[model samples]
Target: MSLKYLKIMEEIKLGLATGSLIAGGKLPSVRRLSQHFSCSKNTVIKAYSELEKEHLIYSVPKSGYYVVAEFQHRTNENEVIDFLSAGPDKNVMPYLEFQHCINQAIEHYKEELFTYSDQQGSYSLRVQLVKHLQNLQVFTQAERLVVVSGSQQALHLLVSMPFPNGKNNILIEQPTYFGFIESLTLHQATAFGIELSMKGIDLDRLEYIFRNNDIKFFYIIPRFHNPLGHCYTNFEKKKIVELAEKYDVYIVEDDFLGDLDPDAKSDPLFSFNPSGRVIYIKSFSKIFLPGLRIAAVVLPSLMNSNFLRYKFSSDFNSSALSQGALEIYLKSGMFTSHLKKIKEVYHTKMQTLVEACDSLLPAHTHFSKPTSGFYLSISLPEHVTAKQIVHMLNEQHIYVDDASRFFLPEYKRDTLLRLSISQVNTNTIKRGIEQLAQCITLIDDRNDDRKNHPIPNNLFLL
Candidate 1:
């Protein structure tokens, strides 16, 4: 076992030497690396420790290790302008204030946090989340809510396990969260995807799927959907709940970004669920601290046992220290204050992205300025693929996510790209979008050139 870990350390060292992995790169977590390399967790830990001692990596408590940025340059030196972040900028996070909360937990909770707390979670965090969920218009008892590492972890638990209610399959929007698809794929669960455009879901198709398939649940991101950045109207939200009730399918609402833009008047699917069909999960990774990996899953009373059983089997429990810190942070009113500050900052960033794309994009390209979320989708000209757009933008030191990742592999790939306003400042947003516009124009210009100057018939001749 020891020698095997030594080999793993050697493999990583070679990567660093060859410059395959660079400074500021994140090493896979111990569990992930263990699974990938088919090694024991302790073996992976030993390997990581070896690298750490060599000054090749360093660990952050709670968070995983990171490759130390080399002053002795090993990788490409090009500065990257990011327009692909799904979370808020680290600088904007209330690090000092959150650290203050962590200190309070250490000072207050004492050695109690060092032990396994609860399979559900720390009681105080659950109490705080009940209040938080109420603000999102999801009134629920603390008993129903389970504190989790993150919303994705909750999703994995929901889809990756058998249900007592006999939910044999899952349904999602045609362009839903990629993580949902990932979970479904990992569990080999049958997934039926219905088309969901900016106009909202195709109700007829959704009903058809529900009527035909034994859909265990409908996994949805109703507010600020990933990649699409479109939220469901109250009418649409109500309509979905009605369909679920009609077809007897559970609804798993992932409101990961719900805390970012809150409208007291608006309600989630959980709010309209009177029959206990909706399982709502709220992720604080975006609004609060991503490193903490804190989220809450509000499950139906029926699912509590099954969910808890799987959760306990998985990791037993989430980190007690992270939950304690968050409970205190939420209680201190700092979470609300941080949200307000980020909203104002991101509002300007979003507006800047809108102006840049609208004013500079090539003719025939189309995009919608999102009203609430951080992402905006761009529909490139039919002739230009997302790959071509991403490649060109990458050359200009700008990075964006291709919309193809949001779709199932068997489905036809769309000529689309997704831009997020979370990471970049107004200046970087402007510069990145301007470069993106140039790529769009260049692609069209090349296509026009190909049209005007037809290829010779013998061009492919040997």
Candidate 2:
């Protein structure tokens, strides 16, 4: 009776008012909403029950709850086009299946799952992870693996920790993952940037930086890079690893979306020098449940103890229950099954998005052609800034990410836009791109007109 339930109801109403939740859209799970509201599951359920009573929402058997309203006479303008969300598709998430695994974990482990566990991680889950990574060509032993809350945690700790080389600066790809950029900023670490694009980076420049700069580690997203959707070739991966070894710079390979790679022969940078030179971090957030907050990092055997010390100081251990459930899911072969389904789903979705971009985008605009990944980046016309397009499209409920935050100050570009295909409806991809193309053309034309008919400088004084 805290009346928090009423607040939940009101939030849902607000979502409805703003047209974000949308008619026939599913609401967040009870567990997810509870975490959001910092309340009990019972409180969320009570709120949902009240919403259902008021004909505002309804729950499906085995499935989660959803809004009760339906889009009546829905038109293209009224429909919300979502290309901004980066989470996994809700239409195919193994929610019910994972819930069963969670229950199984609770039943099997009982109260043990609730208590503090090993600082390194649940050993059993590591065993499963060892088997799981083989598919991605990342060969490693569980003994070298330390599970962290997420890849972000691993990157943050690695940024602050001392490397064997005793170097003070870090090397990162220009327009890299925003989280990692934020981590570097917070730690105030001196970072050098190597420009990456659809054509890949300049190897000679990379070698020059490694040789000249006091570099510790080169953080790389070898496959399906965030905000760019650029995947390096195997040749590039091996050469980069060799360069790292030559310059004594360790490589922190964040292969977060490696599982979605369509090319079976493709390998992570870690595969080139798995012994100790390359530290591989694998995250299940994109491929599985983001809420689980589980990611495994394969470290050098010599660094395992130190990493654990850092891990302990950070949070002592990752969620034991999450580890247990993931272990069960992987060991039962359910994870493999889920991967197979999502592989096809994401591949098809990416293809759809790429096709739409190729067909609709303006000639001056260019986009990354990723084989398979959650993200695709568009380089807007030089005359049109990402801010103008983002602001205009947001009014129509079409969402996109401005990629300026992904870059350091010197490398910042106001022309890049990131579109995530993971949560977007495939059927709407064309329309979204069409709207985007129109926006870009409008801005480009306007800019051209201003240049053609310059406002006199004295007009400002008038």
Candidate 3:
């Protein structure tokens, strides 16, 4: 056997000694063990067979392997918890109902589901989406709607389809969504970053980029913008629309998290620009259930023909069954009820995070109070990089998004971190924040000590 296989067997032996792999307990399949050891099935089988011969384990026909005898002691516990990413809390998901919906959709729409759907999405779903948009005060006719896999795909399609040539550039807010930057880069399109303030994107920098570049489109997440969690002011929204019109630049408005806004009074960019210049995208994933993976884009009537063609070439269509189930969910008013439940839960969670930040974070560390959204971005001391903080926190099993990932390579802003409040409850938020605070304090103290006492090269020479 190879040294590597021997090493894996040794580890397995240690696991057995420590009672980590309990007796009478089923071991992972040969394929799984092979993957874990980065070895072949034969190698794993050899090891298992050796163990079995030694009377350590027994294999049953068809059922595979199991431990032969019980061990006396307990094993070490796994002590890792991820906090940096945001998704629906596993505890909160309505799994039973969601599963029922999925099964029903599959059984009922089996024949039709086998084929490709309409590129612009199912007609029935589009109709429901139109109504949903209308509810959000984003009025668009059914013909203008294009269903996409998710908001990410919607953004990708928009980034790819709207421009006539690859040479055309798009404008984005500095420290924007990392995924957005990735999508823009994939298209080989130049991205101009406008500096952001607490209010929103800096208008002067925005104007400069517009005047200097042959920008084809400007993408903005006006409400509860990713990372920053800053909502564009009503005046700023108007200015953005006016600027887009003046510069003759198309605006890709991502209203992905707008549904969770506590105050639904604020209007979207689409509300201002009913014309084709503003393309509005919305996602039901965050608010409802992510497994649905359903999102819609409001296309201008002028671009409908071309957009439809482009969409067809991409995915043929969104899932018909998902669309059907979503239609039922939307019409049943369960979606709205779910939204209310989510808002209530998220609102409390956001408040808890805010309070934690106030109590736990250093006086020097500063963050904005977000009116709405799942996240809050804090600006740290320039000397303290978000990457360093993330690394430190991750060692303690507390994960956080480093702000640098969101910016363009040329645009380096390291002293920022985004804290997502969506996936965790208020109770857990306290402990997570406390751990995060400890990490920050240690980093800051290390930096202070470094400043006080610099290492001398002469010591190395001596």
What lDDT tens digits, residue by residue, belong to model 3 across residues 1-462? 564655655566666644577768888899998898888998988878766765667899999988776432322222333456678654345444455566766777777766877777878778888988887788888888888888888788777775542338888888788889999989987788887756667787787777679888888888877888888877888888888877778888988888888876788888888877789999877777777778898877877778777667777777777887777677678677767877777777788788888999888888878765877998987588888888877776667788788888888788989988765435456777777778778889998999899889798988
> Best by TM-score, which number?
2
Regions of model 1 farther than 4 Å from truth: 1-79, 412-414
Winner by lDDT between candidate 3 and candidate 2: 2
- Per-candidate total of colliding backbone pairs: 1, 0, 1
lDDT by candidate, in order shown? 0.81, 0.89, 0.77
Candidate 3 displacement at residue 229 in angstroms? 1.6
List where candidate 2 sits over 4 angstroms from the true fold: 1-67, 70-75
lDDT of 1 by residue, 161-243 (tens): 76655769888887877887888898888888887776778888888989999999999998878888878889889989999
By lDDT, the best candidate is 2
* Per-model root-mean-square deviation over C-alphas: 12.1, 8.3, 11.8
Q: Which lDDT value does model 2 have at 254?
A: 94
Against the true structure, candidate 1 has what lDDT? 0.81
Residues forming the 10-long window of minimal summed lDDT in candidate 1: 70-79
User: How high is each candidate's TM-score?
Assistant: 0.81, 0.86, 0.79
Question: For candidate 3, which ten residues in a row score worst on lDDT?
Answer: 72-81
